[model samples]
Target: MRFLSGREAVLKHIFETDDEAPLTPVAVTVTVTREGRTTAATSGTAIRNGDVYTFAAGSLPLGVYTVRWDGGTAAVDTSWFEVVGGHLFTVAEVRAYDADLSADRFPTSAVVRLRDYIAGEFESITGRSFVTRCRRIPVELDGSCSPLPLVDVQATTFEDSAGQTVYAVSVEPVGPFTLAEGEGSYTAELTYGFRSVPDDVKRAALLRIRTLLFAERSGIPDRATSFQPAEGGTYTLATPGVRGSETGIPDVDAVLGRYGFDVLDDLAGVLL
Candidate 1:
């Protein structure tokens, strides 16, 4: 069964008789567990439909869930499934972003890849996600860290290696602060990420996606490509243009430059 993260999973079970016929009016027990916690447990009867007895779950939460089925006697069955999130942008949106382009410019499959690639880059560079989901997130820091690297932090725990609690002294939704000035980790349990994509970022992503796709189709290297001359093996020739900048596309770098900080400097605190 296909499961989407942050969504429900519907499971269906079918049973047959010794003669390979439908087992009608069979009673079965179903249980679902996650992280060693029982989330769902139910007993029901699967009335024969056409040629087979079919039992199914109402729905299960997103995660690796253990599904158990017992049909009395010695017949027991267990299985596993996983849930993952979908693309950040749709194929249609990619096309709409560049109306001058044709339908065949970027195929549905290519669009899927590009959307994910762009979203990942956004988070990696900005330290923030365009998609919004209410879930737990862990924030990390290094020594003498002045600015917090993440944003939209609702709550967090500052702890040391011994699991000792370290007071923040000051905390904010987006922060760059001190955590006892020692080795520790922060496990944040709160709603984070962007619920909506900013117009500028969206535009910049589309422009970059288009630029890369066309360059790939033409067998030409985009701005990120690097060259190493045989004569100068020790020295590498880096691409002159910037990633979002110098792409011959206006406002791409302009938007990225502004959001880059939003990803990096969300938190501002004086180091003590």
Candidate 2:
């Protein structure tokens, strides 16, 4: 399940015994963790409502959080939830992209789902996340120190293999820089990714969603690789078959190509 940031995160759990009977424990407690760090561990009992135990986790920051419930009688359970800022595109933006789209015909929920689906597809193609979040990445020191495999990194901190804070490390905007002293492996806590989706990326998503909506409404195949016209010309789509990166739409692919690995490598001057 997912919740928006700064919203009350009410977690619920139901405990059952071997015979599928609702078993109310003597005491219940909740613990929350994010990015391997414990943010909240409550000793207070969770509110019980019949067989369901609910814990008010309060407003949490943006990230995937893990919740553990200890029922004190070995009735422990774990669950996870994510808190996000918002979707990549808004329904209004979608409607603005295509003036023909009307809420009465398309519906807001459907547009939201399509936007989310396209955002996921965009990430899958680029192997890059657009949401701003903290990530712990393992880095190896090899004297020459290659750039980290990320972009738009905001800030970073380093810790050695033993998890002790390492002060001898430096960084370039997107990756870990040369270490002044130690070698081997280290963990870099990077606060990276774009705070807002780029305009080009949003356009790409909008274009893909338009194609999907068209196919769904008109009953035409989504992606047509090849089509022959009666006028006698055989046309082939310029879909890059490398790991399913291309979307088979020329305009969408054009926008994505600007952010592809090849372009990133060209800008960084280092093959990644």
Candidate 3:
């Protein structure tokens, strides 16, 4: 429920010739572009600190920025990072899952990193995440109505393709409603995902981490297969039933079914 911004970046200059060597070259140009327009331009000396180059030119704006470095000894390379929130689960939560597995606790330094990896895996499997963060999300409202994947909407404005603000007004609750027709485009700044992690989602995450720990101990690949019957007849009704897993892991899928499954998103529409 907290909003955050004003992140800084520090760029490092490492020589390819020697991995440990630091070289400060001439004519360094750092250009920062956000959304599309160039917001900050600075020379090398302003950001240089011995071998390291920091974006101390100014505080980076809240949105995504494209940082470009050039005229250095290395090739013209570009990289990016977002000023985002912390992970969904704390080290304690991750360690609790570890305790459930009877595995030794990971080092404190590695706990956050491990939690991040596990959270990524959970999102990959469930098609959703537990933590909410602010983002400029592009919304397509073409009259096909569905629940917006937002916990809360901060601001929304309709706009045309030419980047001009359209004059139609929208009122909350902003989602799970159909947009009126003939409105070409719109964008919403929303705080998406859950404010607090759901209990079922946490259970699924713990089970998944347990599966991984068991696999690590046993030295087998962390993969499993499961099956479910096709609709229209019970498996015991003397009818041939299809076999497959909704998400390959039964416990995880059972929890996700209540929170994350989207039948329409996975459905293949009929074709002529």
Model 1 worst lDDT run, 10 consecutive residues: 263-272
Could you tally the backbone clashes for each prediction? 5, 0, 0
Best by TM-score: 2
Q: List the residue pairs that clash in candidate 3.
A: none
User: Highest lDDT: which candidate?
Assistant: 2
Reference-based lDDT, each prediction? 0.53, 0.69, 0.50
Instruction: Encode model 2's per-residue lDDT on 144-196: one tens digit a residue.
Output: 54566566667667788677888776665423222223456888777656678
Give lDDT for model 3.
0.50
**Model 3 superposed RMSD (Cα):** 9.0
> Against the hidden reference, what TM-scores do the models get?
0.48, 0.64, 0.55
Q: Candidate 1: which pairs clash?
A: 126-263, 147-176, 148-175, 148-176, 175-267
Residue 250 displacement (Å), model 3: 3.8
